[model samples]
Target: MTLVNNPSRTARAGVPRQARAGRPPRLSGRRLAPYLFILPAVVLFAVFKLYPIGWSFVLSLFKTVGGVDTFVGGENYSRLLQDPLFWTALKNTAIILVVQVPVMLALATGLAVAFDSTLLKGRSVFRLGFFLPMVTGLVAYGIVFSVLLNEEHGLVNWALSLVGVDHVPWLTDPLWAKVSLGIALTWHYTGYNAVILLARLQTIPRELYDAASVDGAGAWGAFRHVTLPGLRPAILLTTVLSTIGTLQIFDEPYVLTRGGPDNATLTIGVYLYQNAFVFFDFGYASAIAYALAVLIGILGLIQFRVLGDKK
Candidate 1:
């Protein structure tokens, strides 16, 4: 029997050369199905996040005071720069960032290390307890903290009274109000960071610790050399996130102190909300929002510069 290859006959039989060669044809629209599945999320993010940000920037250029809405080229921004209240809010926010973030993250790291350590007992219970606070709603926690720190009757104040210390105004006094807010913020975020750091800690190779031990490196040395480097990425991410959150802090200040005691606890977020709803200066509020955004962006850049990979 003679078998001959014929191009015209093969073409009529409807098979491509690539198929005959045991190779598939070039991928087309079907290959893009995965992207297509995620298209809705991209569209939602553009609509909810990107569009609102762009609109807010445009709104910042307009003055909406009383019932009139008129474009006011950089006037609102100029006023923002000159506003002492803005400066106070900014200073308060800066203080929170500097003091609270490191303390919160350090606590979270300690919790993560203990939870991840073999010597630690009841790890599951402690891990759950660390993470439990995060499961509480922000507003609920804020209100709860307000009561727990009440000057005359709060559990904290009562305990202090039992120790012969006079009642400390946790919310009324300026410094105490800031301290109260810092404590609230730390409680709100530490558990979340601990969970993230614990995940990262678990990823670190146990052999590294063993090798360090063989080299006569103690726990502190192992932590300094092995653990820290492993957790850098997670730490940087949480630091940037904490910075942004502090810069935009509002709820605890608003709910706990109402940015009160002579605006001592005022934050950029609370101030922005005050302008928009209380004062009805939407334009000025927009400017504040944008300014906070810029601050957050700058701080994030600084963190990345300081902590990011060298190469």
Candidate 2:
């Protein structure tokens, strides 16, 4: 005799045979294990990040004077619009972004390619030297650059003097101060971008370049058709990261130039700090913070749409 298990019979019984046969039950906690593991991180983010941002908005609605606060609707934002110093800060920051980002990324891409090349010698030592600026203290970096860019005694001006050019005022003149700030930004971030691009470069298979060469493509063609397309994502990443940092730049301008030479290097972040800590105008500072956030968000979206890998 042959025995058959019928689902119809099991349906009539109102429970599957496996359930009736004393199969072990799954604990609810076991099902929730993953959520439990991430709960702490979620709570911390909500408390520290989300709460502070929300509070800043609330603070922006109030008028604060000498450590006292009174309700004042939209006054801080109104004041931000009329502030000339804020406008100056914004203009200086835009100049830095326009000039520094492209130059830094170009140098970074070149360094990445050089490091990845088999013909390059002392590659490890070169990488270490490139990376040394990043891990060092930001204030220390600013101080060293300040001394090295001084008008008369600086090594940079001395080097130029050797070529029959007179000493250039790196921090004393308005135009040169902005230019010097751009140079400092480029030097600080080029290696960081190089490391990121190099990591991306390593992942690209060599077969693509080989195929390009076989197709009679020369060095420039190989880079254009193969390397650039593959590096698109990394370029976008570094660009967006650099944009955010540039928009929020403070320590370098503050330490090196003190936003001086007639406010040539006062960025939004440095100005925001000045409003909050220096002037003690918490309400206006909060409004400035919000404005900076909105600007960053808009620029970030533009970069994504323009440079995204889809087309």
In order, candidate lDDTs are: 0.92, 0.91
RMSD of each: 4.3, 3.6
**Model 2, which residues run further than 4 Å from truth?**
1-27
Give the Cα error of residue 257 in candidate 1, in Å: 0.2
Candidate 1 — which residues are off by over 4 angstroms?
1-36
lDDT by residue for model 2 (165-217), tens: 99999999989988888888778889989999999999999999999999999
Q: Candidate 2, clashing residue pairs?
A: none
Per-candidate total of colliding backbone pairs:
0, 0
lDDT tens digits, residue span 174-237, model 1: 9999999999999889989999999999999999999999999999999999999999999998
Query: What TM-score does structure 2 among the candidates reach?
Result: 0.89
Give the clash total for candidate 2.
0
